[model samples]
Target: MIIPAPPAPSTPWPLPRIKLHIEDLDHEGAAIFQGAVNARDALHLAVQASYRWLYTVDNPPPKVTQILLILRSMPGVAHTIGTGRDGMEKEIHFSLEYIVHSKARATAEIMGVLVHETVHCYQHNGKNTCPGGLIEGIADYVRLREGYGPPHWKRRGEGAQWDAGYETTGYFLAWIEDTYGAGTVSKLNHCMKNKSYHKRHFKDLTKCSVKKLWNAYCCLLKDDDGAKVLEILSARDDDD
Candidate 1:
């Protein structure tokens, strides 16, 4: 809670113990990463990004006491793991392979991945029962909200289900925040804090059921006259 940080104004999020491990120092990606970003600043910024997007200054942040960042020649970009037992100690495994491939946008890409994974470390999981896509979506949503979304990311057409995850649901949720009002996603995150995830939760907050929202979103995408469609969609007040 309260980010477990001191009142001293050094960093935004309570400065956690940042441990960095380079498994393959000889790897090219490791060198690129070292050159592109400062380890301490990147980690601290990622935590701040999570807090700025997800929590208010008055709200209690997650009790993440420490984070261990492991840079290795892994297959994927990165993934964050919390202490299997305690849930406070988080470990981030960043792939040197992904880094090497993203040389052009190394700084932003790395920061984006770091921001995304950091959200996973801080956000609640509804007792490990939250849908995986929704979980991933929220992470990307925070990253996007932080202005770290990649250049290629876009507000995807609502083809797949809303929970299809990644930037798809992330953009949709962003739209929800913009269209309805600010703090819509924040409220959604707070709803998941102590209770299980459910469709009715969406209904209770937005007045429209999740299915109805998704259907309306998809319909808006299908209409050729985008402005008119958006107007119709916006007219359905979501205040609750």
Candidate 2:
């Protein structure tokens, strides 16, 4: 059966208030970031991309009132934190050093990181019971869907477990969406919104256990040639 497409919004969702904070202007990475993209536009695009892929007009999540983009010297690429008494405010702390290191692809990399991190601000976490890998997988799924996935990403049938996160699980989720239906991933996200996550959510959505699905996906990779996997991986919503 063909999966129905997600409902499209007649109008764009109202965006959150966006703010920028740079910890060190003199940092070379900061300079690269400033030279690469406009902070407001980048953040706006990232948020919009998250909304476009993960939500529909009929069932949007609660509005994030404010998003503070914080650029600083950090060990990792970026992460998001919730602020405010009600946790309606979010802060995205990005590493300036990583930005400099990825200077050649700074614009796309920065936008990709923003899109990935922005997802954490809005995605439901199964009442905080969801595995961290699945959370990160969903985030990267949005980034991949938005067409910002880096060049180095590849599809591998082995090595790590399915929910190993990042592009690995992102690609697996993408395959599920393609084989089952268009809104499969969206449904998975929604299922986690109100209740604690169970592996059964996978069975609930796809009518198959997560382990079974993973095995099937792995078998598909091994049986098919690279070109076929590429076709499946490249599938995307034209409306997006």
Q: Model 1 shows how many backbone clashes?
A: 0
Candidate 2: stretches off by over 4 Å: 1-8, 225-240
Candidate 1: tens digits of C-alpha lDDT, residues 32-55 = 999999988999988887776677
Can you write out model 2's per-residue Cα lDDT over 1-240, one digit (the tens) per residue?
123334457888888999999999999998999999999999888888777778877668668999999999989889999999988899999999899899999999999999999999999999999999899999988888878889999776655688899998988998888777777888888888799998888878766777766766776778766555444434442211
What count of clashes does model 2 give? 0
lDDT for 58 (candidate 2): 68
Q: What is the lDDT of residue 160 in candidate 2?
A: 65
Q: Model 1: runs farther than 4 Å from truth?
A: 1-13, 224-240
Ten contiguous residues minimizing lDDT sum, candidate 1: 1-10
Ten-residue region with minimum lDDT total, candidate 2: 231-240
C-alpha displacement of 167 in model 1, angstroms?
Answer: 0.5
